[model samples]
Target: MISAASEVFSHAGKHSQDEIALILQKHLKVDSAGHLSNERRISPTRNQWKYETFSPVWGAPEGLNSKFAPPIDDLKSIRGVRGIPHQSLRSVAQWINSKIIPRCHMEWIVSSGALWIVQLDLEWEETDQGKDPADATMVAEGLRPISTASKIFKAFTPGDRTSWPKLKNLEDFDFGTTRSGPRLYFATAEQLQQALATSGPLLETEIDELTAGRAVLRTDLDRTDSGILNLPRTDTVDGRLAVAWLRDTLPLLSERFGSLSGLAVILHAFLPARAAAWAYFDPGTPIAYVDALWGLPDGLQVLPHDSFQVDIRRGRVISQKIRFKPRFLCEAPDGTWRYTEVLRLKGRSQVLSHEEAIEIGLRTASIAEKLGQDAQIMWFVGIPNAYGVDANLPWYRAREKAQQAPRSARRYRPVPVSKQDDLATLPQGDVMIRLDPEAPLIRDDAFLDEVIRIAQARKLPVELQGSLLSHTYYRLSNGGVPVVLAEPYSKYFRTRGRRVFGKLVRDRVPVGIKAGGEHVSEARLASDDALPGLFAKLVEEGQELLQSSDKDSQVEELSDLLEVVRGLAFQAGAEWEKVNQAADRKRETRGGFQERRVLLETSLPKPQADAQLDPREIKLHEFLRVEETGSFASVPIAALVSKQGYASANFELDGQPLVLTLRLSGSRIELRLEEEPSDETNQGDLFSAA
Candidate 1:
């Protein structure tokens, strides 16, 4: 199973700033003025260790060691856990003390039963990557280390994990941004002095633009103010420009918007990543899709790329396709980002592992569910972690259909060509061009046209011999001709060919010569309940052809594959034209198979509705209500709704209420009753009894 650690921290970054603030409020006791409480705490420092541990802090002696508690043995075991063993605490302290620069921050949980380290912050004062694993102490002490403080709280608290993005007010401010104003004003004179010190000579463009506009100075507005500050040119460094702009606009903004003290200044550090993924949920089809690229996801939507489809609710990938990626965007050494040619990746290459894709898909689904609408997110995967940089709803919508959709009538016509070409008027006489399997199979229209010209010069009828697809394209580009195949085709192929090809299959007869011929009409109307089975067989054969090294076998397989398709369409009483139109519509909406996607697995969720309950759920529901009595009889029907393969019911037994959870354990229904007062009633016994 893919760990939710990456998703949790990534979401916490930008999308769930409110949750980040809450985590700080609950654990770090960060107050208004960005002050940490005197309370001892362990804080995560945004540092990572070996892609496994999210953040590992040093000093736990001041935060937790002196106290006694049970040790955490599993990562997930942190749930409902209140403490750690005294030795585990000491080991954490030892690790922190071993560091030369013991810059540490710690916090203690009051609500949790024991001294629980919610967060950890460490300053090792070393650049060596080998010194990163201060967390190895906790592991060495037989205690399970945690990823983030939020992960611990999520497991112990009864609330949904933070998933989506939401904008909030200053009270919940974990991060902030700066907005410009019309005129300059500083809270203090020192700020103005600082701005002036950073100013540089203006550029020609700035001077020209300034000369073209009105010139007003601070001294003009107020005699007490200093003479007009010559702001740096816009062409200068952004910092100088920003400082100059703020110096000019702050006062004007304050005049219009009132007090500016409430305004917060944010200094954000860029978390650079070489690769990114753009993931979204289409609620209409209710599937999750992710498009990944080398650098940032900027402009990824408009680019041809690889993608993966996931079953939203079940968190399983339904299909994945890796196309020929000729170029990838990445950051340059000087800090410029651009697309660069990567010849090695030009061929079909999997950019992300299966585990990474699953995590991304599940996280996308979680976000969409939280938003209660279709949404998308941009994620950056810098080694050891992924970051959620941005998220928003799509700006485009599907094309609207007509109120009264037009009906397409099937019509047959000769392939249109320019009248000036005498070759177009040439008589197509009886001459079959046998395509040798060993020869180069060039499908270029120009090459095929040249071949046709030679045949026309010979004044012989042209009967094509190739795969059905090639023949179909040829007829569509040129004109109709009989497609000749060697005799002794499989019975199934012959029957399908007769229905699909019409008179084109008759001995020496060209296609499109007769409409609704006897063979075609008879084959269509004939009872072929087995057409569906034949289609499945052909599909399986096509897959085998993909694996076979023999090109002839592959060509042969593809040759008759279309015959089964057309036969199935005919069997359904639809014209080939109508089927093609339907296929076009599907391609526009769901996309095409040009990338050659493969369905790796199907982990679809079991049905949960009353009308479509899984058999185990039905049996459990029945057993709880019918086969069992007393507490089970009074259980709420809604409580039996299964989630994550388990359901819990709260009911009173012997005048005391307890929660009995039921989950499928192999072939049996296992029961775990919590808050039971009797020591004799073991959860194992209850499972056995069930």
Candidate 2:
């Protein structure tokens, strides 16, 4: 039956014997009386119980201690008085006498894997209520050697242990029951005050407020025992003390508790790793030191992926090795320090590292120390190459060179020679010579024809009679060319002749006469004798006339006269080698006259040629032609002067009254001088000798 039970036990894995019994009792039909009666057949004899106790004596190692013996006979002697089987009696004795409870001095192995030995340092406060023996034993095992009950009593009671009275029962003594009573500890008030002197009275008060009057117990917590402390623990006072120490030592961390909480929230939200796998704490130190170590302030939070080293001494943080990179510097602005999966180079080549940043801070401090209040400091981060340093550097000179180079390379090829030659060609048109009728007959077509004749006679290169005479009858005697001639009293002659002729018939004086009568009507004869001399006189007279006119009028007249003189002189003196030279020189200095003449002479083709002159020279020549003739020579002077009071009958000439009439047509004046009957020179032969 026992083998069957063992076999069942083996088959059922970890099932209990009770469970097997229940299964058997439920499945198999057995009377209870019979079951009990059958159990006796399978049982060992009465001596076997004693043999069970003695078996270790023969099979155990030779030197093993035998202190585990049970007091079986004493239990049996007591149990025999109460009726039972002998084997049952022995079983009862073995069970009752077994070493179930440990001795007070023996070491015990804790369920947490730690070995604990009972020490003499068990400390307890005497109370009206007795201490539990189990609690007392646990405390003894946990405490150090010097924390014994007697020493604790002496320390708490303020008396010598030998002098304290011994009581028959602990409950009889009138002792305090509260745990708040004083106890022995290393951190005394005086020592605490001395240690906190530099931190000022506030810190001292804080420390005192946190720890004062509290009973302190010392215990060494070792990691080998899996003894670990967390932020929250069963000992509220100790936990609060730890928290207060952190807060006081690291004020910035306390201030940034919200940031830390936010980081925790982010971690929780993302769950990048196992929940609650890591923790953070204040590394009690100065803010500057923290800033230096972390390359920033305590507020500069980070999302580290693994275990990290926080050295309170150096105020530095070093993270553990991790496959995942630090995704972000949590305190930086959004996106500035964001993580990206794309592989890229990072570190010193990327940005300033924490160490470099701290070194920069130190250098900055040194510089600030030297520069004092005048110093200004600025900080920047990121790859140096990412900035537009090179792009922004001045390129003014380069730009200027670039701009100028293209312009300079644009070659300015000279205008084609053919185009220039084409431009140089004379233009074809009529050359109109505007004549002033009042101008001397020496300036008439007769003179003009003489000039042409001379030019022809000399075979000079010139265009003659090709010129158009304006403001007069068109006449040139040498070739019978149509010349403009002025009527005796036409507005064209009357207006122009008034200045030299005055208001009399004798006013029509000949040219070359200077306010004198001998030179009258015979002016053209001088040219017959000496053409050059006559031309000299004419030029002199023209110059005087030009000078006499109003400045504006004089410029105009002089300009016109220069054109005519240039042409005529060129013709008359064609036989002379210096004629063209003189004409050209005069043309060059004659205001804008010569330029206009050259232009017209070339462009108009003497009313015979075919090509046109250049426009610039044409404009100049037009100005010269208009200037040579005074404006309005064809307008009658009498129309300008009052004629209302003049006689309406026959007019007289040389004091002889004659029948005559006077009339005006447009700009012309008409006068009729009739013969008067006279008894004097007209009477035939009366005074003549027979």
lDDT of 1 by residue, 107-188 (tens): 4332333334555555443422321111111111111121212110112111223221111111111111331111111122
**Which is the leading candidate under lDDT?**
1
Backbone clash total for model 2 is 25
Task: For residues 1-690, write the lDDT of model 2, one tens digit per residue.
Answer: 689888877877665555544234323221110001101111222122221111111111111111333334432233222211223333332443253221111111112222122121211122113222112111111112222222101232322232111111111112234311122322222223334454444432332332331212222112223222111111112223433443453333224332222110000001010011111121221111111111111111121122222332233433222222212221122211122221111110212244433433343333334333211122222212222121111000000001111001101111111122322332333222222111123223344444345323433222111111111112233233323211111333212112343211112434434444222333333344444544544444454443464787777667655554554555465644476577678767875443434422333236666554454423221223211122222322222222231112434457766643333322234454347643333222321331
The candidate maximizing TM-score is 1
TM-score of each: 0.25, 0.12
Q: Distance (Å) between predicted and true CA of 379, model 2? A: 4.0
List the global CA lDDT of all models: 0.38, 0.26
